[model samples]
Target: MSDNEWPRQLPAPDHGEWHDPPQARGRVLLAAGLVITVLLVAGGVAWQLMSNGSSQPVTQPSAAPVASATQPSVTPCPDPELTVAVAPEMEPVISQAAATLKPAGQRCSAIQVRAEEPGVTVDAEDQPDVWVPSSSAWLRIAADRKHVYQTSGATLGWSPIVLASPAALTAQYAKDGKTAWAGLIQAVTEDRVPVITMPDPLITTTGLLSVHGVHAATALTTKDPGIAQLRALTLRSRLTEAAADPSALIAQMSRQTDAVTASFQVGVFPVVEQQVTIYQKGGYRIPLIASVPVDGQIEADYPFAVRKGVKAGLAEQLRDAISKSAVTAAGFRTQPTAGGARLPDSAAEMLAPVKQWAQFQSLAFQVLLLIDNSGSMNEKIGAGTATKASLLRESGASAAELFNEQTTIGMWYFGAGSVSDPAHTEVVSIGPIAADVGGKSRREALAEKIGAYGPQASAGTPLYQSVLDGIAVMRPKVQAGRPAVVVVLTDGTDGGTRFAMSHQDFLKRLGAAQDPARPVPVIAVGYGPDANMNALQDMAKATGGQAIAARNPADLASAMAKAFLAARSAT
Candidate 1:
């Protein structure tokens, strides 16, 4: 909306007194000279803080333009006017500042901030003189979107990226007085789920940054970031709710545990300090868990970029004035603290892999986990004490429990010893809370069924034929919004079963039987070294799914994650 259309003044923003240093309490150091500066790196990653010291805050002059004592007193002309298309979340602060700004006897230009979504406004027909996105990450993205070779902007508000958790989980962080990014990742890996709310990164900068933030904090240099793979492995593991934007997600997921029922919602997400403060003042109960990583925090540096035809001087004045307002009135950090070093030029290169995470769907779907329980499946997996079937069961249980309840899931066990084998069964029917096994809900029942498979794993794997039948079970229930898929976990390729159809024949039938309108992806999980990764990949790819290989105990979790992640489009 335009400034002219907004209220002359917003009701003084009920915010209490702003803290000069904001809520400063933790530290996570960044490697190299990439000392976590407040800058937007390319590829849409919000590189918030630039500690390299190549320059000062965009609007902060060395000494606020000092006037000599002996200079003659002369009235200056009215300063130029500049329009700021401010991000929706920052509009109140910017507008409030505009109202309180003084003229000093000479109109030092009029500054106006109007709410705008950077993705939309940056390419609008009537462009604002200045663009203030919530994250600097959009500066380059906006420029590139416009097909323009270049666009320049400066950081106006520096709010560090922080991990905000519900108070219920705050105890985990209270001990060390620091946020543990690794701990969160490890918990997800172990199926100790952390409920987090996620926004679509394509639209929200925080959503985009959250994907990168979590991965960067958890990924080691020796390993792949696995951001997508992580999401795949732990589908809905960390998230309990999903929303259109970060704030809405937080507010939606933000709830105190029901003391009477002993039930609580799970969710924590990356939000700026300013947001946390605003929410608190607005009566949100969730508190900051730890605003840290240890090396450094990802600064949420709001950048003020000038579009074509905008006067540079006016843009500069606006950048300075808005930045100053963010600090003095809104509690944002606009400059580096004492002894802070500049971020290295190499930091941009490191941000390359983060782009993929932003495109993640994380949507819920209906799925059936088809486990191969042939006699060969009982073989040991690598040198590990557990057999392939045991590890599969563990991973399956973890994955099933971690998926959000919104997802409809079921399970099936298939063996190759002829189609009439007594062992083959539809353990969990395709439904929510599927026929409570042993008094446990579908999730629990499935877990128990998987965990109990020991000496019972006998007969040949009806891998191909079982999937063909499983698809029949899943296809009829497929709905428009809730995609369906069949995930086949096998330790070996299709063979040895008397009732098994030829691999080629199975593929043709699976292909021809598929209804494009009611797609059901058949994803494959090759559980052991004997499994055929090549054939599995092909079968999965045919149904718009993927085949993941668990070559050993170590790759089991990651492979499962990759397979689950591929399930999004499987149907």
Candidate 2:
């Protein structure tokens, strides 16, 4: 019905009441009453509408909206509280990220960040809801220990492992181009840059990765140069603890004018790239430079691991809130491809070097150096100008430099007389190298003895008898924590005149002398091609020692280093 048109007044109810019987008359009266009521109501509405139109047009009010229980509200749910455990180096960046998550503004989570070492976190009984470790290796370590966590499957930031050194020492090398691990190894080995400190592999992931890098670079070689390098460092006390702060080293390097002295005083260390960035900002006298290994960069890919029970929404929110800009601004590369080298996927493969380093550290040295002064020693080695005896003297002095004050060493040269008649002459009895002997250090006296020794041109080799007599004499002197070793350097087969035991008899006796509780390994060096290597090998195997075949001066020197390392670390 149109609003403007008033309802046509109902046809005037027949106002004339019918003149009929009493019942009919009563119904007619009721009908008339209903008509009169309708007319009165319509007339009243018309009167009100006319009065409102005359004054002003009427406006109707909208119906009130129903309060809904299921509709979404304008305000958001309360922000959740999240606990984050991060690596020590990542603490600052992660803390900055946490502050950006304001509960009152963007409705982000309330993050509680704590700086923790990944090694400690791996074994922790109670873990945080979120964990950001410096390297993904820690995740493998955690999994190996059955510490369950769900990785975000993305790295938050990246920093490659680098060889950190003073810019002054490495200026020429760095200017040449990016240095490889081989170059670093060669430099350290040649004493171009003397001291090289490595963090203890057992204590820090940086140390673990550094050793792994060295191992990977030398994987194809028969014996890693790292072993020899490590042995040298151990003897020289150059391998320092994981006290990585380089302030003292920088100060010492800055003052030294001589390159050799500076090399000895200052050492290069392996650390993450971010540490170099932080160190450079310190404004030290000697600025440190980081050389990324070109063969493969062992990087610290900061993994964002989420615990099982943490809400997925909260975890994702946190991951997104930590922006790429923030990460880069904090000196972290946002991409996983930042490193050139890829680490081993398996946890055990990555941990192999760490185990080897631990073995190297467990050595306590007590060694006997038995040299052959037989006629064969005067023969030239492999067309070289140096004779076997001359090379032996040189290598012996170098090896002697490897022993610290704690090592007990003795020297003996044998080739004359019979086995029962004291054929071998002792140059120095087994004693501490630092001990005073004849008003001079035993080390000095020993050096002098090795330098002056000459070959006995008429003497027989007597190889079997010398080993037997050395073992018999040294076995009783074995101390509890020290490994007692008899290192025999021979160049020919035994020329026995029915006085020395046969090779087979020697092997049997060596095996019979074995004491599982107290082992004394016989590390024998078979020098030159004609040496009795088979005999030496058999005897060495019988006593859990090694037989090294040395063809020339270089081979003898290298092999001797390995033999000494094996002897020191035996058992």
Among these predictions, the greatest lDDT belongs to 2
How many clashing pairs does model 1 include?
31
Candidate 2 has a TM-score of 0.57
For candidate 1, what is the TM-score? 0.63
What shift in Å separates residue 222 of candidate 2 from its native position after superposition?
7.3
TM-score of each: 0.63, 0.57
RMSD in order of candidates: 13.7, 34.5
C-alpha lDDT values of all predictions: 0.58, 0.66
State the lDDT of candidate 1 residue by residue for 390-447, as single tens digits.
6666656556654654568888887746555643578777677433456656767777
lDDT of 1 at 356: 42
